[model samples]
Target chain A: MKKIFDFIDLNAEIQWVIVIILIILITATLTFQIWKKVKPSNLVDEMMLRTKSWWGMCFIFLFASLVHPIVTYLGLAFLSFFTLREIYTLLKLRDSDRTVLLACYLSIPFQYYFAFQGWYTMFLIFIPVFLFIIIPFLLVLSGDTTDIISSMCILPTSLMLGVFGISHLGLLISFPEMNTGNISGKALLLFLIFITEANDIMQFICGKIFGKHKILPNVSPNKTWEGFIGGVICSMIIGYFMGFLTPLETLPLILISACIAILGFMGDAIISAVKRDFGVKDMSDVIPGHGGYLDRIDSLSTTSSPFFHLIYFLLLA
Target chain B: MKKLILTLIYTVFWRSFNKIIIGLKYHNHKSLRKKKQFILIANHNSHMDTMAIMSAMPSKYIHRVHPIAASDFFGGTKLNKFLMKYLVNAILIPRKKANSDKDIDPIEVISKLLNKGRSVILYPEGSRGTPGVMSNFKKGIGYLIQKHPEIDVIPVYLDGIYKTLPKGTSIILPYNCNIIFGKKIDFHSLEIDDIVLKSEESIQKLIKRE
Candidate 1:
């Protein structure tokens, strides 16, 4: 692996990963096409739309990853902004909450800016600490306490998850030590993304095939114990093989992959419960088949921070 | 040159703001570009309504599209008048001068625009009202369509713009807004009252859909 990395040039791992991703997307598209021809149904049509969206997403991911780090930061920041917007829209926040909502949006750029500047202390505490107090203060300034408790709870938590949580991925790129030969922070970022997405697909496939016993019937009816276990194990295996992408050892990588898989499921379940409570099937139809930015990045939003911290403790510390 | 600047602004700034900041969505709008000259009637709730409608049009027709605005409201200040005239390309008509013989008739201005193969965006509700609630569309639209029987009338349903920039608010919040264009209705044989009622019904039906 080191020989191949040395032979190709800098960013070889990232290039190889992009190539692999493209191949996977093309395979998925071809498989969907063949499957549709063999068995045409609403399910197939939906799957085809999903695969088409994946193609678009892959192209974007490739562009953002291969381009300048500033582009990746901007893309991540915009994603955070849109997901937060989607959450705010669903919460049906009052007009009085507009100041707090704008505050929430204004915090997104600063959060990502902290990450970009490698101010880990500021990035970690910005939204959860400072904005937590300031948001409620702004809400109180409005003096409309009719549903103050709900806004108080929803605004901070949404900002924490949608903005603070996702900005960690951008922070990964700023790690100076992660830039070594063909292995850079981009590879690590892509590794986490690929594993999280793979785990989602694995769990979904396992659930459809072997999902009999419900894991959480109230929160996510489709989730099953069998699917969860199968997905984690599969992700662990994939993570072990892809351990070269990161600086971690095999055992830690496998364990961390399992943690990510479990956390991803939890993330999906949490968002699912939010949707269920709101009586919404999807967050929004921004993405053609993936529902919304929030719907697509729910798992990533949850898994990113934990993954970043684990790597930080193991390698950086 | 002013028309060119308007199209440039619409294409660059206004379109991005609508799509990115406000998250505007369109439904059944494929045929909107094919429309050469038509009257677009939509529900008014926000100051963003006219800009949103104009931004959604093809840049080729953007210079030719004029949103009819009440002079008293939009022409209150010199700055607002400049923006309404130059930026928005709106035809400001006096709402209180219906009986005045001196001023050009509001319907006549709209008819002249339509006669010259230009499109006009008319809010049948006349003014911004309660958010998410539809009031009775005034008979002005019915009268305008009656004069230009050859022009097609497209009923548009705008949802969630009020949430973004509702009445009595200058702060623009980010929200998902929808613009649904309905099929063109020909009211050649229908009575003016029927046209008014049918146009309202058409927009109301669009609101109930999804």
Candidate 2:
């Protein structure tokens, strides 16, 4: 406890950043609530409730960040469980794919276990390579070759993004703090979370205000060019100041911020496409305001892996 | 004491076991809870199907639900009868026979239960069928609804239960199984044959969602 406080005292700037972000979020919620009263719109109510849920999520995340890396890893494992559960609940799974689904769900614990051990090679290749082969073998052994093509394609795709992709956040937190006066893994995880979440919020706010051109109307109707540009710029500015949380210099931080924004946008669209294909309005109504774990962390699904790789090669290498 | 123990076993022990092995997904069209005495018919595939329905049912309705099991299969011995009567809360009726005098009619037993404001779960297919293919519903369901036209018949589709624990298999395989409840059908104006066909049709429609 004392050590955590001393670490907080040392990284007081990051502490201040969290406080400031919380204040801004609260102020935005209040302003939106008032705006909702003057002009009652369904969109405003959804946005207001979404903002409220964000406050709850942030506090939970802040507590996790303050705790040990094990807490962060377990928290992420829990997140992966919820996300995969939602995916399974909505996915059009075949009878033969049942074993494959079980294997996929079981792999969540193994993936996090690898992350806990800091077994990077196992963590990275387990789902994409090993499960990629194992899932089909299990399917074939079931002796039902019907819908094999679609099942093979969809199972691996869902497992990769839904389970393995989200597990990278836990892997990111397994990195050891270096000797060059760097922050701990929890701080880096928190930084990635803040940037990605802020980017999403900023994009929503900007799109609502000045969103005329539909970027991909078929895939994601709400995404707009104006919103995307505004969000990227704002997140870049925020990410530039957050550079102190990592060992990156000015140029790398800006580049990382841009990567998060763009890749995060792509992630959001990919999930939206899947949801649209599935004819589901939301993944599941598990969370009160946010639809599901998938809905809340769609951007993180895309951003986490690339962001981790960028930092790994640029600084850790 | 029996109802309490059965409810506990179903809720705690069977539910968790089946839930882990066969991931059950439920899609209820309307609030089936409010209807106290409707006939619940599902495509039978495994012994677990009745247990799945028992677990998914609201606890208040647990005691009221009497799943109709085969007398020969479940009531062959005194101990089996005790288990069926107590643990399963089952109404053991004889399987279909050509002679009506020797065998007690299942409709009479089911109607008696329904008149007492108790829900009865019927497997219209008589016994578990092959996993994917649904068999023709027996005329018993139509006759039950015909005799007691006031009762609403709810159709249920049980998906993937055959593969989970098919007949002649003691080992339970972990598979993704779903139980979907279709809308309640009113047989007041329909013929008995139409009632059976429509009831089968409603259940067949739910399989499409799978």
Candidate 3:
């Protein structure tokens, strides 16, 4: 296994991560297949659909990561675009909000461009500082100030969460410090994504099996104390072993993963609240079983920036 | 050759645009390619509606499919006429014929296309109505169905194109849209009013399905 990974053009860490993901996917497929044969239920069918989507997602993620940096940038930008578009669709913004929404969509490419150029300062402030003011101004220019406050609130937050937060993953690749030895920025990205997604899955499983006390019944009825604690612990354990992917020490790595797990939960809860407020079960049915891009990336959207900043502060800063 | 070029462009451009930008999903899309000739009726909102329907169609059937667009709207200028005729493969029929030409009938134009084994997309609403609101379908569709009872009428309910590129807006916001192709209605032995009522009800049912 080591020899084959080493022989591959990709760094051994990324190759190993890919192998681990494949093993998990295959095991899940087998487990689901067995579960279906044993007892056919809607849960099994839903899980099968989710697993199929995961396979496609894994392929796309692997392709984006393994290809040149431009592909990764473009892929991330497209994700942001889709996320923002999904949010706008869900918000049901008025025709007056169209111009502002257009401006918000246009900002995605610029945000990713900054990441591609490795313009850290500009990337950090571009959406938050620049578009923050420009969006509302554009809304004002539209001359339909009915529900302007909501537009002001939703547009900037959408950009911040969808574009600004997710663009960190792109900027992470441009860091020269992240490309140390065999573990490049791609490995770190894969590590972040794996931990974030694994934490989500862990929380879900724990909640299903051992969940009793509701955490936020109003926002998300499914989340529980058991899920949160169990997920964080499980994430920390995974992060400790996956520490080789990053340049951080063991203590910092464990702490960061815990933060990621907690933040990931917060992100999921917030998005759930937004969906519940708007009376939507899912953002959209873009992905077959996963709901939409926003549904799948809610955790990652909240985790990406924090993960990026933490790594930067610990290693680069 | 122009038709072939248009097919190629639709296969590549409109398909990709609908799939990627619009995220156009379909329900009962297989039924669309099952028939060689049919009247595809959908609620029109944006110019993207025609493109979305065309993109949903298979490339082999694209050349034979003509969306019945209004000449006054789509054929006002020479360039619009050329593009509407060639690029979109749309058969432009005048919404209101000139006083001099009393014989220029829209149904006759559509029947000619059907006679050639070509499918035509008709917006029974007659024009683009308010976004997200279904208007009363005009009687022209009923008249056409009465004349050609042999052709099947397929009701397609298009959602979210108005939000993507609504009327009075050229800038397309990338909002996901869906095309729901209802089961084909055989208007055989049905009156013009019955045909109209059935098709309208079919689309209304699709809107409720979500």
Candidate 4:
């Protein structure tokens, strides 16, 4: 125990203290949550009570799993798998669309494979050109063209943006090649997920507390302009300070994190449009307080491409 | 040999291409394709209701199911006669025919079929009412319930079929519907008149959902 304390770094000790503080916060929050459930609230109050559990669980896992590298990757991989499956459920498929659908499954391994192998070029090109070109000809050969134009527009775009676009978490983890200890990879991943997820919680709270101006009332009734700007400003300040603990540049860090925040909002809106078209709400009832696989990973889907694009230009290019 | 020949000719080739594309959903869909008998009482909308019923049920249970069709609709043409005899294997029951002395015994026939432990699908509304409302049922179905009161009643709710093939529409477009099967009901200890009233109530509850 004495020798273990001898080589302990100051920053590492601060991180440990932060982790401990988070654990206490989660425990206290959850206890109050149970109290709310037992004492019984009205309908609106009951909804907020359950939503507290959702926000609580998200933070507790994020705090604990941020330090573990392999645990974080596998966790993100499972999130990708579920979000893709939910997308598949909402969209209608034809016989000619089979090959394209199969190729969509291939992206799961390809995304993680690139992340695992630490390659950047193959990860970017695999989805855009290769999968893109191969899928349409397969549909053309089937010769069912009555809904061909509609199928071509909707199917490939849905698979690309919803499935392939969101899978850039693997690429995000493979960034930060400068650190000698191989510790920064885990730090960067944990930092990114924590900040992005915090945006979702804060926006919901802000929207409920002080929302007035409807942003896109036709599309998402709950979303307000006040919530969007509030979430962006909060995430930018959070991501900027978070970068000081790790090895990331400041100006681009805040600017890019704000961009990630806006795109995250877009990602949530796009998936909402899919649910709207089919006249359904909340894809599946798998998660209790959270809507579904699609609901949980809506923000992570938008972070992948831009975050990695910045990485390519800054580090590899 | 007969079943094999029929399966080879219709099921494998023709039914594959000719299978109707109607949306079907259920809450607990685990046993949807199972062989449990469903008295699929639906409000008659068009001449194609029985065909919709047959195609909607999975191929496993299609052969055993017998539909009670009105004598006025399928009792005239040779093609209709072949379909009623062979394809659906419908039990042709006469409607209110003008001044005919043929007193057909539907209660005894239905009771005997239920006694043989076979499930039959009958439209309890007698004939298709105007698009939405179900007409009052005739006494033959009520009498059948009185004779054999052990069979289960499954209420099937079909949507969009009225618009798909309405009364006077010649050309039909592709549409969808949901065939919901309720839980089984037992009437083993009820009186004869009570059996009729209860059966009527059970069917009415299923229709009231639409």
Q: Cα lDDT of all candidates, in order?
A: 0.86, 0.79, 0.86, 0.62
Q: What is candidate 1's lDDT per residue for A1-317, written digit by digit as tens?
A: 43335665546566667667878888988998999899899988998899899889988987886688899999999999899888877788887888778888899889988988988788889988898898999999999999899899999999877987789899888966666554478889999999999999899889988999999988888899989999999999989887778878888999999999999998999999999998998999988888999889999989999999898788767
Q: Could you give candidate 4's per-residue lDDT for residues A1-317 as a string of tens digits?
A: 11224464424623643564466467756766676678855644655545665555656556435545466556655556655655655566654555555556556677667665666677667667666776677668767776777666665675566556655665555554623353354455556666677687667767877899998887788888888889988899878766644455787778777877887888778777777887777776556667776777677777757765764566456
Better of 2 and 4 by DockQ: 2
lDDT per residue as tens, model 2, B14-83:
7777665455656673367777777889998788788888877776668888899989788989999988
| Per-residue lDDT over B1-210 for candidate 4, one digit per residue giving the tens place of the 0 to 100 score | 434534544455434322332222333223446646556566677655665555555555456667887767777988888867676667776665335446765555666666766667787778777865667656666566655555666656554455445666553323334444555556654665565565667656655664
Give the runs in model 1 whose Cα sits over 4 Å from its true position. Answer: A2-9, A180-183, B28-30, B100-105
Ranking by TM-score: 3, 1, 2, 4
Using all chains and alpha carbons, the TM-scores for the candidates as numbered come to 0.94, 0.77, 0.95, 0.58
Docking class of 3: medium
Clashing pairs in 2: none
- lDDT tens string, model 3, A156-213? 9988878988898997888766766643778788889999999999999999999999
Where model 3 places Cα greater than 4 Å from the true spot, the runs are: A1-4, A180-183, B96-103
Clashing pairs in 1: none
Ranking by DockQ: 3, 1, 2, 4
What clash count does candidate 4 reach?
0
Q: Give model 4's TM-score versus the native structure.
A: 0.58
How well docked is model 3, in DockQ terms? Answer: 0.76
What are the chain B TM-scores of all models? Answer: 0.94, 0.91, 0.93, 0.75
